[model samples]
Target: MIKIVLLGAGNVATHLYKGFKKANTVNVVQWYNRNLKSIETYKNEVKITDNVNNLIEADVYIIAVNDDAIPELSSTLPFENRLVVHTSGSARLYDIDQKLYRGVFYPLQTFSKAVDLDFTTVPICIETLRKKDFKLLETLGQSLGCVTYKVNPKQRPALHLAAVFVNNFTNQIYRIAHEITEKQGAEFDILKPLITETARKVQEVSPYIAQTGPAKRNDKKTIKRHLKLLDNPDQEAIYKLMTESIKKTHGH
Candidate 1:
């Protein structure tokens, strides 16, 4: 079994820990973090430590912490000639340097402590400097989920930016829509089926083809009406910007 030591225990860490446990092929030998509460269950399963020096000897060590802390944590690690990996979408894998086998195991999806991750649907973006390390990453990723891509830092950033638009911006739009619907005495739950259908259609059709709403049709009157209803300048500005972008892309 592949001996793995995990670092950090946030949303990503918790999901990965559960995934690793379910994997059964690899064994999580040890873990460490600043807070004990973050990884109490992980501690129960394997050796856990607050001090970095006591880091268990493992074939692989994954740092699933904040993007800013990666450089600091990687620099502080005393382990030599061990495979070190980070699970971050925006962080470049090389931030950890070439002195050790450093790689990225970025899972492209929103993670919440309460939500169960559908690993099979989550795209795993992976990269490594060494050929052997890349193969090792592929092996582990396949067991967790089949969709895996080997991408460079430049390409990874584009994917990350696209995700921010699809996930964050879209969710924000949903919130605004919910507020407007509530004020109109319409239950936001009525929109859930439409939301699900829209997501489902995207799987089969290109977003350009599945496009709907007044923005796609260049209905300026409807756009103005919606913006006036929004009232909030920030939301109106966002709505206008997104509408313009969509028209620029899909409009003739």
Candidate 2:
């Protein structure tokens, strides 16, 4: 069995704790957070501690804290030469103390504590400094029924940047749409179907092929009308920028 000590109490950590619990081959031996109350509720299920010196021996220590906290936390771990991995999409693998076996087990998906996520659907990007450690990390990821990929340092950052465009930036645009709909006294729920269809289309075809709308067709009149409808300068600026980008992509 892969015995893991999970450290952190945020969204990623919470989800991973649940996923590991459901995996028969994995045992979350301990969970730690600087703020003990954040993870005190799980004390009945597993050992919980706030002191780094109190960490027990485990096969792997998974650090799921904020990107900035990774280096300091890894450095403070009482044990070394053990497998230590972080669940950050953008943080460097070497962010962990060199005294330990450093690696990354980034889940390439946005996680929210309230949202129900299926582990099988989340892709795990694995990277290890030592060649021998790769298989162990891969097995850990597989234990949760996640599809694992060997992503290098160079590629992982690029993948994270692309993810920001697709997930974070896309969500912001959705918020903008919601605001626009609210201004017109229209039901924002009416756009739900379009959102679903748009997401479904990209799975079956390239985004380029799935492209449509006035901007893609270079319909200047419609673009101008949209800009005029957006009274807020920030909203108008975003609309114009996205329209120009779409037009450029389609060679308009």
| Model 2 C-alpha lDDT per residue in residues 1-252, reported as the tens digit of each score | 999999999999999999999999999999999999999889999999999999999999999999999999999998779999998989999899999999999999999999999999999999998877889989989998999999899999999999999999999999989988998899999999999999999999999999999999999898888787888999888888888899999999
Q: Which pairs of residues collide in candidate 2?
A: none
What local distance difference test score does each model get? Answer: 0.86, 0.94
Off by over 4 Å in 1: none
Report the Cα lDDT for residue 57, model 2: 96
Candidate 2 has what TM-score? Answer: 0.98
Q: What is the RMSD of candidate 1?
A: 1.5
| Candidate 2 ranges beyond 4 A from true positions | none
Listed per candidate, the RMSD to the true structure in angstroms reads 1.5, 0.8
Count of steric clashes across candidates, in order: 0, 0
The TM-score values for the models, in the order shown, are: 0.94, 0.98
Where is the poorest 10-residue window by lDDT in model 1?
37-46
Lowest-lDDT window of 10 residues in candidate 2?
Answer: 222-231
